[model samples]
Target: MKRGEAILVPLGAMIAGLLVFGLFCAALGLNPLAVYASIYKAGFGSWYSWQNTLVRASPLLLCGLCTAIPARAGMIVIGNEGAVVAGGLGAATVGLATLSLPPVLSLTIMALSAMVCGGIWIAFGAALQHYRGVSAVISGLLLNYLAVALMNQLIEGPLRDPSSFNSPASYPLTPDHRLAYFAGTHIHHGLIFGAVACVLAWFLIDRTTFGFAMKIAGGNVRAARLAGLPVGRLVVIAGFLGGACAGLAGMIEVAAVHGRANESLNAGYGYSGILVAFLARQNPLVIVLVSLLTGGLLASGGVLQREHDLPDATIAVLQGILFLFILLSDTLYGRLPFFRSRTPEPKPHAIAA
Candidate 1:
């Protein structure tokens, strides 16, 4: 596909989505223009709003990678929510155990634990797909339910903090162990972590030989196997990397935002990340920009509810519409004459003769 089409097609789809959403809002007796204005005001009108958007974008960036990485290997894993839960559980367990240790060491150990747990969670699905012939998508979906069940059981039973009665959360991290915010800003260091992760992911996928192999495998599994590529290993590794990113996001949520593993850990960020990844076409670098856009949409939900009397699910509806439009746009690729390459025709042989 041409670069212009790669960018323009999605942009056009998003514009169409917005128009449909506007009509939907109009049908509900609201001014579409005012609703859009409110969204912009609440999401990016001020530094405070920008901070809110960035804070939310932090997790979206990581979670989006959960799908984006495996996508390069032609894996359709959608278990980011499960991996996130597992990561949160792992981080909480390690963080609570290492309270006596230095904060830096404790946090580092917690992060590693989270990554391991998350990587295993998703890699298991990949393994099933490769060896057991199970669909990665189905396995991932089932695993999401399993992870949530496990988290609920642990938080409500063995790992429950005595002080967290109403919420049933895991033990909280100490203040020193929690992630610190950027200087003079409400945003946490997680934003930096997310941005750095995106950049590194981009380099890993776009610049590395391993990434090249994965792309070849994704493009044609049979040809890749014929060429002696380790397709199974690539699939598992991609799943692990994707899951590891999500797991880190889970840890960030616990250590920076919630300070504990709780129900709040499943804040729909995982699902939202899928949308961001799709919208960005699974490009790690573009994920950063798409995550910011998604984060803004999420941050504006409260404002929409308060000012326009819209339901909280309004953003979700918009997302659904946008996703549909994006899927439709996929069919137009290579078919549009504007994006097709022009081939020069040979002059008549008779003229040369």
Candidate 2:
């Protein structure tokens, strides 16, 4: 596809999605233009709102990498939700257990625990695919349900803090171990982690030899095998790396935002990250930008509900529409006439004869 069309087609779909969603708003006797403007204001108009957007985008950046990385290895795992929850639980467990340790050591242990737990949770799916011939997608999706149920069981029963009677939550981490906010903003250090992770991911995928092997494996498993590449190992490593990022996202949510593990950890950022990955065409660098855009849209949901008298799900519907259009437009990438290469017409120089 031509470079311009590669970019324009997606933009066109986004525009189409907005127009279609506008019609839906019109049916409800609301002005689409006003709604769009409100979304912009609530998400980015003020410095405070920008901080909120960045705060939300932090997890999204990590979670989106969960999908984008595995995709590079030709896997379709969507079990990041499970990884996030499990990671959060693991972090909480470790944090509470090591409360007497030095603050920095305790926090480091908690982060590592979260990443290992999350990585194991998702890697199980890859293991099943490689060993048992089960589908990765099925295993990953089913694992999400299992992870949430397990988290609820542990949180409400064994992990729950007795003092937190009003809410089912784990024991909060000590103040010293909790992540510090950046300057005067509500944003925390997790944003830095997420940005650094994306840059690392991009480098690993584009500049490293292992990443090239993964691409070859993803493109053709048979060819990869014939070339003596360890396809299974690559898939497993990719799955682990992806899940680790997601797990870290969960850990950040607890240490930075919630201070404890609870049902609130199931914030759907995992699912939303899938959209971000797809929207960014699975490029780790682009995922950062797309995640920020998605985060803005999510932050605007409350504004739409309050000021416009719309349901909280209004943004979800628009997102769903946008996702649908994006999928439909996927086929337009190289198929559009503008994207196709053309040959010059025959020269008329022979007429001189």
Steric collisions counted per model: 0, 0
Top model by TM-score, which number? 1
lDDT of residue 24 for candidate 2: 96
**Colliding residue pairs in candidate 2:** none
RMSD of 1: 2.2
For model 1, the superposed segments whose C-alpha errors exceed 4 Å read 344-353
Please state the error at residue 246 of candidate 2 in Å: 0.6
The 10 consecutive residues of candidate 2 with the worst lDDT sum are 337-346
lDDT of 2: 0.89
How far in Å is the alpha carbon of 9 misplaced in model 1?
0.4
Superposed on all Cα atoms, the candidates' RMSDs to the truth, in angstroms, are 2.2, 3.1
Name the weakest run of 10 consecutive residues (lDDT summed) in model 1.
338-347
Model 2 stretches astray by more than 4 angstroms:
344-353
lDDT digits (tens) for residues 103-152 of candidate 2: 88988998899999888887889878877899998999999999899998
